[model samples]
Target: MNVDRRRRRIVVVGGGVAGVEIATSLGRRSKNDQSMPAVILVDRDSAHIWKPMLHTIAAGTRDISQQQTPYLAQARDAGFEYQPGEMCSLNRANRTIGLAPLHAPDGRLLVPAREIAYDTLVISVGSEANDFGTPGVQEYCFKIDSRLQADAFNREVRIRMLQSVAQEQDLSIAIVGGGATGVELAAELMQLTQIAEAYGAPALSSRIRITLIESGPRLLPAFPDDISQATEERLESIGIRVMTNSKVSAATTEGFELDDGPTVTASLKVWAAGVKAPAFLTNLDGLESTRGNQLVVLPSLQTTQDPNIFSLGDCSSLTLSQGERPLPPTAQVAHQQAQHLIRHLPAVISRGKRPPDFNYRDFGSLVSLAEYDAFGSLGKYGLFKGTTIRGRLAQLSHAMLYRSHQARLYGFWRGSLVWMVDRLNMRLRSAIRLD
Candidate 1:
């Protein structure tokens, strides 16, 4: 079972921001130099979508087709191999990972379970909402974590809107969690109602009610206090109910039951609270993990149990400073870590150099409260140190993050073309996807 010392094979699992970046970067190198390692990316889904934009899809504010990058096509363009299947097990001793059988949409088995050998493996399987085992949440609440789930929520919203118009009743949506996903979604839902009203359903706006529930005292706890306050005010101004310090005891078909407060009777319920790495990772070949199931990795982004296997994005937990506060599960962290590995991994694999520690720079965070406005504070560093941005500028900056990600994946020229096409499409089609 000995692999050729000269032949290096890198298999990246997850196809998230980190995985795609690493795969494409390595693939680009190996494409030009045949002697470089072979790069293969495996993902359960056929397409990659920016995790940040999932809420917009759920609210129908963004079109799925515009945002999704097909894995097969991206692999071809970026010079990598793409495998469409879920990773089921890790055989570190054999340097192989097991893949679950692939099936068609109609439930037909397409490919039998198999294993792929890798000299090095990068796992970026990302994370899911942590319900904290809250009773009835899994049955009664909706989560906007993936494209399919978001699309399903969009379909549900559209149906409810139609029903609301027919019955002349209010459409109440209760979102649990005050983080970016929940806050941004509340705003988008409000804006979507406006868009729906303008597009022939004039009564829709008045009938739509958005209630954002936060267990904490305020929204966006990660952001500065002022930013959180401003977000709540903005949402309140739009007639969206902002419930602070509200703890949900359980969810029901009718709505959510608050531990100490009155019942929230919502037609639709959404849970967007605490995040935990995928459950499967806890049993991932005895890798050291957090209580939340995130694979515990050193600052070098390599797992404690296996140096050959690296993990990033939400699936991995990394502590930066003395206090040992783990970095937030964010796209920013993932992007930085991916770049770090891309730069250092080659040296480690080819030159027998130790992988350098990854240092994360917080460029600050921006929260887009729908199309009307956005706000955020920039972390103090360089020329723009300690600067706070709001309004249109913040909104534009928020958008540029997604655009930058696209540029990375598709290269500058093609990504710019996409931006232009999307702008043109906005003029030609409905602001929201009707389908």
Candidate 2:
């Protein structure tokens, strides 16, 4: 297909879930027609993985290999071009972007920084863990914000487990952030110890100490109080200590020192507390941003100052009308925003018009608390006006979120087949604890 013949050129930055979704959808829509716009996906990494699954990888229940999709392969299959490089700056006035130098580990320059022109630029460069300017966090705490960070935490966990086994001592893990990531990681760590013991890792049966620290009064501050209570109870039942109203004043190599001056030492520390837009985004010329440095996007997902530039996922602060608060940085919200853009972009490209306001629909929330089970609220049901499920049902629902995303990218038939295959693979393989 002569995609270049089409006047519209769409450039999507970031290879995470949002970037891939938008690129894939545009490519699929343009497949049999040469008049459709060309799509290019850009990111520093060559592979794409679901950001929501990083916590599971850290806990060692799921191997990172199984969770990642090669960007080259996906681009080829989806009919889009894949470009590997970090974006240095965006120039809305010139309709061009600045690219950073690409280098090899041996210090050889590969691609000299060059500008890429785009009729429409979609900035989906996802957010990173918010340090809140906390002291020692940059040097000490492990964050699961990216695949690299997740891998680092996984390695630390394995090495610590080995050392603990060698010394015949308990393995201690401290997780900061009581949100979904923190709660999920705490549960996954417990499962990892069980899986490790099955694999004959010495002294793995002893008490595994895990502390979940949250600054809020309860876990899952985003969810309803009932759901949060259930999640807290479930964690405590599994012997995972839940500490609410606790703040990490500083992180040391030894462990986290609490605000009240109590030091909690651990073999590993994970920071999942909050998210902030990447620092580079703040410097984008003429773009209005939030306190967290997220690009301030209008209801239509376009930046207020630049209609040609769009952003979604955790990177943009698009507020909802109901609560007058920015939408939570979740996978579902990003997916929904991408779907809206898929429908709206074609018109904007072809007719030289912008779409009307777009609003987000809340699908409730789900939190998977390791193998002891999952708990959260689902929006579809009528019981209590919002049905809350825990245990196996909740687990199935939690798994389905990824499946739902897969279904949207691929069709239902293909997505279902992949899901079944993955389930079977999990059954056959000796579980490798990544956390």
Candidate 3:
């Protein structure tokens, strides 16, 4: 069972922001140097989309076809192998991982279960919404965590919009979460109503009701108090009902039942309240994990159970100081962790050096609410508080974050060209996907 270690391989599980970036970065190095380890990225999906843009996709604010990058093409360009399947088991002792059998959409088996040997492993499977065992959530509520889920929501929204126009009824959507995803989606749904009207639909603005339910005191709770307040006001300005301190007891086909409150009735409901790593991570063959199923990692991003294995993004939990609280499961944290490994992994894999600790720098957060409004908290730890941005500037900065990610994946010049094409496409193509 001793697989050849002559050509070392680094198998990265999950094609998320962290996993893809690490694969691309390490793959490029091995492409240039023969001694570098081979890079293999494993994922269940064929494409990679920015996790932050899922809400937009669900709302049909942006074109999903253009926003998503095919992982096969990316792997080819970055000089890595893309293995399509989910990680089902980990053989840490054997330095191997097992991939679940691949199946076609029609339930046909395409590939049998297989195992890949790796000298080092990186787990970045990301996370999903935690419904907190709320009854009927899985059956009655929608989630926008993955691209498939987003696209499904989009299709349903388009159908509902048409039905609303025909019946002259209200199109009501209830989102149970006031975090960035919930807040941003509420805004985008408002924009969708407007866009639908432009495509020869009825005067739908007045007929669409968007309700955002938050268990906390305000929306965007991670942002500063003022920023959260401003976002709430902006959302209200757009006709979205903001329900604060309303905890959902369960989601039914009719709507969300609130604890100690009335049940908000709506056919289309979304659960986006809290986040937890995939349940599979908890059984990652004895890896130390949090109660929420996230792998507990050191500052160097190595799992406490095994140094040869590392984790990042939402699926990995790390706290720099004792009792400081684990870092938020955010795109910012994932990007920083990916870059840290990209820079240090080469030396560790090729020259056998100890991986350096990853220090996260919070450059602040920005929330862009479609074309309605935007807000930002710039600088580290408030950056003196005067660095806050709002309106157009904040929206622009928010967009640049996605562009920077593209630049990293495609290289600067190519990424710039892609951006230019997107700008031009906006002018020529329909803003919403009609199909």
Candidate 4:
């Protein structure tokens, strides 16, 4: 079988960090080799924004437009076809997937239901907040799962601030969850309050209050104990209340109902807790999956039931033979997996060869607490081991991660231009978004 002689169609569903990298890399690779597969990148949105920055956007400290990459532009620059739609179903027998109809904000139909065929498929649609069937969560809490959601949250904050200033009333916000997303949001929200005051809202800082509620015994439970302790203390110093081991059994119109019968009241509520894949994925074509609905994949990232289908990032679960737990869902994990596929996918598709097992390299995690403080442990691959960094050094390392990501997607000169523009914007514009 001369696999390289055939024209292969590769369709990637999702435009996340992993999906964009794989699609762009594959498209570029195929351009030089006529025998390689043709790539199509399908996503619900026409633009891509790094998920980790959602908290900053929600806090109004970051502008969404400046950070987002338009998908059509990306395709034109990277040599791939861009299809915009939501993936609704998978047909294994026919090797095709169904996309739901696209609609406009005014309830007008834009695109009809369609199906796309693929010789190979990659699923990278990321996870969403897991409410665990908690009552009122869906109805009451604001979430930061998508770019639109983050923007909406910030807009609401601005509206509420205006009303509070007119009425001379204090505004209260309560966030549920102690994980990275929740912690980062709490810090950023405080920073937003400070910036808001600087913009001439004299009493805004003192009139706004933030309370972080965590079900766990400590914040950032994934990090070292000392780091978590330091983070809590820093948050406390900023006038944000930190509540640990305070599980909320239910949410109400007023606020959250604690498990022990106490109630915490707030003007705005946010749920930033656990995460699970989209509900539709659990039943997709009978593929093996974890309880959280993450597709079970082999070490090579191919779905257990279908060799032509693969999954990565937050949507896939792979428990190495030597490990008791699956890899943590993080940007670095997704980026590394995409790199592995870049190296091996061509061999698997073009030469009928096996994909080498992927090995994840962990360099540790960092937490950014707005502009006040940052801390984390950095570790080298082998002999160098671990090094702890705090304050300024940790803050710089955190910023470098996002810059490196931009460099990957935009190339050197373009990425440098973006950095320069961001610096200029910081000096010219107000720190927080007013519009």
How does residue 64 of candidate 2 score in lDDT? 80
Candidate 3 global lDDT: 0.90
lDDT per residue for candidate 2 within 1-435, as digits (tens), equals: 234733578999997778899998898766655677888888988787788888888777887877777888777778888888899898888898888989997999988898878999999999888878889888888899888778778888888888888878777889899999889989888888878888887558575699999988999998889988988998888778899998889889888888875888876778889989888888698799888889999888999999989999999998766656788888878888888888899889878898777777776788887778888686643544477778899888889888887786667898888789788879997677533
Candidate 3 per-residue lDDT over residues 1-435, each given as its tens digit: 111358888889998888988899888888777788888899998899999999999999889999998998998899888888898889888999988899997999998999988999999999999999999999998999999899999999989988999999887899999999999999999988888888988779988889999998888889999999999998998899999999999888889989989989887999998999999888688899999999999999999999899999999999996438999999999999999999999888778888988888888898989999999988576435548889999999999999999999999999999999999998998987788
lDDT of 4 by residue, 1-435 (tens): 112324788899999899998888888777667878988899998898888889999998999889899988888887778899999999999999999999999989999999998999999998888889999999999999888889899999889888878888899999999888999999999999888788778888889989999998999988888899999999999999999999899999999999985799988999999988887788799898899999999999999999999999999999988789999888889999999998999989879998999998888789999999998877556554577778999899899888888888888899999999999999998888988
Q: Estimate each model's TM-score.
A: 0.96, 0.94, 0.97, 0.97
Pairs with backbone N, CA or C atoms under 3 Å apart (clashes), candidate 3? none
Worst 10 residues of 3 by lDDT: 1-10
Off by over 4 Å in 4: 1-6, 379-384
lDDT of candidate 1 over 1-435, digit per residue (tens): 122346789999998889998988888888777778889899888898999999999999999998899988888877888987889899999999999998887999998899988999999999999999999999999998888789899999999999999889888999999999999999999999999888888678888889999999999999999999989999999889999999999999999999998999999999999999888788788899999999999989999999999999999999976535999899999999999999999888888777988888888998999987899788755578667889999999999999999898888999999999999999998999787
List the global CA lDDT of all models.
Answer: 0.90, 0.84, 0.90, 0.89
Q: Report backbone clashes per prediction.
A: 1, 5, 0, 0
In candidate 2, stretches whose alpha carbon ends up further than 4 angstroms from where it belongs are 1-6, 105-110, 380-385, 433-435
TM-score computed on alpha carbons, candidate 4 = 0.97
TM-score quality measure for candidate 1:
0.96
